[model samples]
Target: MSESSPDEPPNSAAVLESMTLLATLSTAAEVGKSVARRRLGRDPSAQEPPDRAAIHLRNTGRTLMDLLMQLALSRVPLDHPEEPLPHAVRHFDLLLKLRRAERLTQDMHQRLLSLYPEVSSELVEEARLLRNKIARFWETAPSDPDSPHLSDVLEQGISFVVWTRHEVPVE
Candidate 1:
């Protein structure tokens, strides 16, 4: 359809936001796959069984990839000031969880540290504490299915990762 045609849907700012979201999700998928293949040892015939560390790392990466895709699909431009913030916060939580798992891997953590110098030693310690808190929350999942505090914790934890000044590629 012609861009100027009245019958054509207007490609407003929201449409650009959707495109950007799609691109970010595509990049996340590529990064997640690379991390899994390298860290998890995709070769089925590998001599050693994947350790708990490997399993957790792979699971976290996979979860982040899924969450990123969900965020892409769920996003919309902030057209109305009164509207709730985008659910990208959930994706941020997943990213933070994956980052925690990455921290357990010395190489991965160091790579991230080099790339994001803002993650100081103190911040790393804080992340460890937050990880424990999230773990504790999970332990009481059944009892806290609708816990308001859980949502608040997740939102605050995710806000840090999501608001970082990194440029994620779009495909």
Candidate 2:
């Protein structure tokens, strides 16, 4: 076993925790995308203007997925012993933001369903499926040592959040 400096963390545990957080974030992004797709499908009629909330949600989800994909496919390394804890903290912070976004999206979905009662059942069912998938993903722990570091993952997530905010111009 390699000994870490006093200021550095135990590498294995920190790496595992960071990977797990990234997995959860990836799953959350997938759920958001699924929900957004369902919402977008609600209004098939071209006569009505597109739903801004749905559009924003879709854009946000897509942005998240893009970031996750970029991070996963990149060659960035997480081998630094001193970087894990800060990365973990940033990941945690981003996770909170993603959760907040999900909640807001859910609220928008509820409001949309209320406005159009006929579309309620299908959209709700779709959302339910997505939530179940996310839960399953969350239950799975990440054991891959080759996974990217927390800083890289957090950077991607933050970029998505910033980009989406600009693209959608929504709260």
Candidate 3:
């Protein structure tokens, strides 16, 4: 990937590759958005368009792509980690960008409480404890931290996300 001057255009392979990927993303987004339309379930004989869920799915796809791209491209605690992390040799969904991931843990905990009042206080506390564990996931330089594998919890979180991706009454 060659760097371009301010007056010139970038001719790097990365740029071309990104452009191609964006085109593909557009196609994929349309497919996902199309399926969400309300008219899809309608009888064709009755005559109607699709029943579109809403336009927000565009942001959904873009956000997912951004996370996927970040996960694929780099290792962490990186992309500018907070000061004082002694060891940062880890990269997976659970611990990637360890600092940011820890932050997201708290944000998600709050999001869950705001969205679902019925969510148990115990569960919220569990998330808080998990956040604390994550905060120290890479504290030790040459050995594992005190926390158990947080990826186990992340796996369940990812599973539930996938489950929600389906329509109601999943078979």
Candidate 4:
């Protein structure tokens, strides 16, 4: 792939959104792996449980937000669909808010690959299935796009993840 020069203009909004989402998904994957390690009960060097837990949880939230952004951007197939920028930004913001307290499950890995094979080199079907599940959840419990409740979930999830990380005793 050719790299654009610094003076070059931005690509279409959809492209930009896709790139952003990709970056976020990568981060989420790393955090998810950390969470998986915690799930297996590996203890880290943080003296306090809460502090250690908080660190893991924050990483998980950051990771999920990225994946969510990727999903939202992929929803628009058109090269430069009208309003792609706003929709992409809105979804990106929402994922950042839904931030989970726990790390992503192994299912996340399967799903991500299934959905974005170009990025994951793994089965895309897994990600596609997970994506569908999320779409269904939203369809069933639709909320105001601008509600703070979503962010609250992220905050709570972060705490939960951190606590779980602590539960794993040092080996």
Query: How many clashes (backbone N, Cα, C below 3 Å) per candidate?
Result: 0, 0, 6, 13
Clashing residue pairs in candidate 1, if any?
A: none
lDDT of 3 at 150: 46
Model 2 compared with the native: what TM-score? 0.33
Mind sharing the TM-score for model 1? 0.31
Candidate 2 lDDT score relative to the true structure:
0.48
Cα-based TM-score, every candidate = 0.31, 0.33, 0.35, 0.31
What range of 10 consecutive residues in model 3 has the weakest lDDT sum?
48-57
Model 3 residue 157 CA deviation in Å: 4.9
Q: Candidate 1: where is the Cα deviation over 4 Å? A: 1-118, 144-148, 163-171
Mind giving the per-residue lDDT tens digits that candidate 1 earns over 42-155? Answer: 532232222432344344434543543444444444555452333244344444443443333222232234333433564435445555555555455437765334555455
lDDT for each residue of candidate 2 in 17-113, tens digit (9 for 90 to 100): 8768876887789688768967877532222333655464556456556544454444354466476575665445444444444444344344334
lDDT (10s digit) by residue, model 3, range 7-64: 7634445554665575577557755755675356732123221122112222332343
Query: lDDT of candidate 4 vs native?
Result: 0.45
For candidate 4, write residues 1-171 as lDDT tens digits.
Answer: 678899774466657678588768867886787799688876332233433434443454356655544544545554545756555655555444333312253333332333232332323333343334444344443464543343343343344334434432333
Report the Cα lDDT for residue 101, model 3. Answer: 47
Q: Who is ahead in lDDT, 1 or 2?
A: 2
